[model samples]
Target: MGIIKKIFNKSRSPEDGIFFEEMRKILGFNPVDLSHYRKGFTHRSSNKTDENGNPINYERLEFLGDAMLGSVIAAHLFKEVPTGDEGYLTKMRSKIVSREHLNELGRDLNLIKWVESKVSAQHFGENIHGNLFEAFVGAIYLDRGFTYCEKFINKKVIVPYVDIPKLEGKVISYKSLVIEWCQKEKKQFHYDVFEDNGNEDVKHFGVRLKIDGKIVAKARATSKKKAEEKASQRAYFAFQEKINKK
Candidate 1:
């Protein structure tokens, strides 16, 4: 048998009673159709196709969950912050649905314990937590419909974590702030990123944030996006006083 098939078999071998009970506790209600919930936790690596030969995994569900999260959060923000303009509302929504926030939520729920993947958990990046959380939301939407979906989100996300005052000050992306600052001030900026893998076991990327040909900050991380963001953070601090004054 294929390695993926073997992994799928192992993943499916868990007791339905135990899994259902665990899901019930997390869901705060009994699930109707268990298959949708199962699909939410299923990873693409399982190589399991449905009776219709459709690829079964959490990815498509993730898309739905993302949209659901945005809309729900947007509505809450709209009702809560009536004075907030479009840009303010948009920024607030971004902060609330930020990947970091979602990852934190997933961790709080201990959602990763149920994932079925051929790849080991440790091998999975931090984003896996957020992705699983989203897929789970999608599953809730599918299994119970939008009313239940909204309730679950409110219970898990809004009531516990949504603090309007706190979210307003949160910076989802320092890189975005830095870029916006540069453009508003009509300054030329660049992120010179390159592979920084050396003798280390893991690959890395290095970035230098330059403003008008002057290196303002430098950073290195596992990915180019992270490296640039880190460098931008440093640069933001370097110009914090000036940026803030503007």
Candidate 2:
């Protein structure tokens, strides 16, 4: 048996779960309530519920985590960039808390292995990483409260991942930038997005960018935001010369 096989072949025992061990190692502390972490990793497809029959999954935790992450990032940015105005600080916070970066962080930590889900990993979309990361953050907040949450962010996120200069140049939403530029340039633009139900297992959306009533670009992605961004990118390239001239 090879290393990969050996790793996967480990018995998933109830008493000594390898995943829980890994979680403890990653978290640097033993979890007070394993159920919190369990729910943190759970996907809504599992159809789980608490004693009161309320849905018990990471979605609610993800919501909580998102707010916490934002608060932490905002606090850090505020102190780090004391001279930064609201727009600058807001942009920095956005860059730090962006879904793409959060997804990268979560994936690097391999948070998916703990998830309890009926769906296959192959079936899940990329956003799962970021969402799961946020869910885990929420779990930490609930389990350990604000102090530990702040410590974790500082140690795991701020110390390693955040750099002021790099964050300043980071683009959280290229689509937003393109739209802003279009509006400022007095150019007429429209995005026509429609659901595309094709042979793929997941539903997708197709987007076309119309500039001055002419089709400038088109794109398709798993979600509307993705499709819009892709269309915006294509539109940006198509109108690059014209937009840059102004």
Give per-model TM-scores. 0.63, 0.62
lDDT of 1 by residue, 1-246 (tens): 453453244444358767777788888886666788788889899998989999999999999999888899998889999999999999989988999999978876778888888988988889988999999999988877888888899998997668665567666778899899899989999999999886543568999989999999999876798788778777876787776889
Clashing pairs in 1: none
Q: lDDT tens string, model 2, 41-64? A: 889899988889999889999999
RMSD of each: 12.3, 11.3
Model 2 lDDT, residue 193, Cα:
97
Best by TM-score: 1
Model 1, which residues run further than 4 Å from truth? 1-14, 170-246
Question: Candidate 2, which ten residues in sequence have the lowest lDDT sum?
Answer: 1-10
What candidate 2 gets wrong by more than 4 Å, as runs, is 1-20, 170-246
CA lDDT, every model vs. true structure: 0.83, 0.80
Model 1, residue 2: distance off in Å is 40
Please give me the total number of clashing residue pairs in predicted model 1.
0
Q: What's the distance in Å from true for residue 126, model 1?
A: 0.5
Model 2 RMSD in angstroms: 11.3
Which window of ten consecutive residues has the lowest lDDT sum in model 1? 4-13
